[model samples]
Target: MIEVKNIEKSFGGNKILKGISTVFETGKTNLIIGQSGSGKTVLLKSLLGIHTPESGTISFDGRIYSELNPDEKRELRTEIGMVFQGSALFDSMTVAENVGFPLRMFTKDNNKKIQERVDFVLKRVDLTEAHKKLPSEISGGMQKRVAIARAIVNNPKYLFCDEPNSGLDPNTAILIDNLIREITEEYNITTVINTHDMNSVMEIGEKILFLKDGLKAWEGNKEEIFRTDNEAVVAFVYSSNLFKKVREAYLKE
Candidate 1:
């Protein structure tokens, strides 16, 4: 599990996160959602140590990141697996190489071990035959799968996914969300995903953080979103046609 306590972030003079406190539970999909310019992005980066929180404590399991030294920080980083907004795969590398990159860099394992791990992850993501293809050779959804394989190849305890479903059709997006949620539950990893997609929220939002500007306006599960009386959350929920239909269906039932 990941625990974030009293997190505050600022840039020059603009404060971003305003005393945000939340616990991302293990073996569940924890979503951070908000409109554009909300603090969700900053919160994700803050958890990853990409952005330093001025007055917050982020701990993985029990170890606080702010208290770690350089070496310790690097060690902590190794335990984190990230699927970036765009797959972020190297265009030049084949699918196999991209999936195996972490093992090659982080461990002294030989070729046999690396290939075994790589193939295992690829099969786990259902991309066994695509390894020989370059990232550009695959479709957008396939590229995201490759990215997922790479993220899990290292067997990370923490998984961070930033817009994992961006630029894909709704059908493909749902597939990716389910895949992520399944992996999180199966591995019992503390997974944090930052996204604004309402479908994703309804599908796998076991725990959610709703951010507005720089503050956490609401926090709850998918069902709670519709039942809440918070104005900001109400606006966010009803604004999207998809969620409007969802709210209607829930109300009618």
Candidate 2:
């Protein structure tokens, strides 16, 4: 589990996150959703240790991040895995190499050991046949799968995804969402995803945090979101006529 307590961040005169406090439970898909300038990205970056908050503490499973020593911090980072937007795989490397890159960098494992681990993760993600394919040689969905394979190859305890379904078709997006959820449950990894996709929220949102203008406007699950009387969540989530009608139908039921 990851805990953020009174996290406040700013850039020059612009305050991005305002004393936000939340807990992301382990073995569940935790989602952070907000508008363009609502500060979800800033919060995600803070969790990733990219931008340190001026005040507040981020604790990963009870270890205070800011207070960790240099060596301790480095060790903590080794347990983290990140999947950036747009499936940021190395175009020059094959799928097997991409998945094995972390092992090469962080472990003393030999080539045979690395290959065995790579093959295991590839099979886990159902990409056993695409090991020799380069990033450019595969389709978008396959690229994202490759990215996921690489992220988990090192057996990370936490996984962070930024706009994971960004450019994929709806069907493919659903597939990716399901895959992430399944992996989180299977490995009990604390998974946090930053997304603007409402479909994903309703699909895999075990815990949802809704941000508005830097503060947590509301926090709840998919079922609670539908019944929420919070104006901010309602306006942001039911902005479309289709969703509005769906909400109405649910409330009527």
51-160: candidate 1 lDDT, tens digit per residue: 99999799999999999999999999999999999899998899999999999999999999999999988998888799899998999999999999999999999999
| True-vs-predicted CA distance for residue 148, candidate 2, Å | 0.9
TM-score, candidate 1, is 0.97
Candidate that scores best on lDDT: 2
Residue 246's lDDT within candidate 1 is 79
Over 4 Å off in model 1, which ranges? Answer: none
TM-score, every prediction: 0.97, 0.97
Candidate 1, lDDT over the whole model:
0.92
lDDT of 2 by residue, 16-129 (tens): 999999999999999999999999999999999999999999999999999999899989988998888888898899999999999999999999999999999899888889
Q: For all the candidates, what are their Cα RMSDs to the real structure?
A: 1.0, 1.1
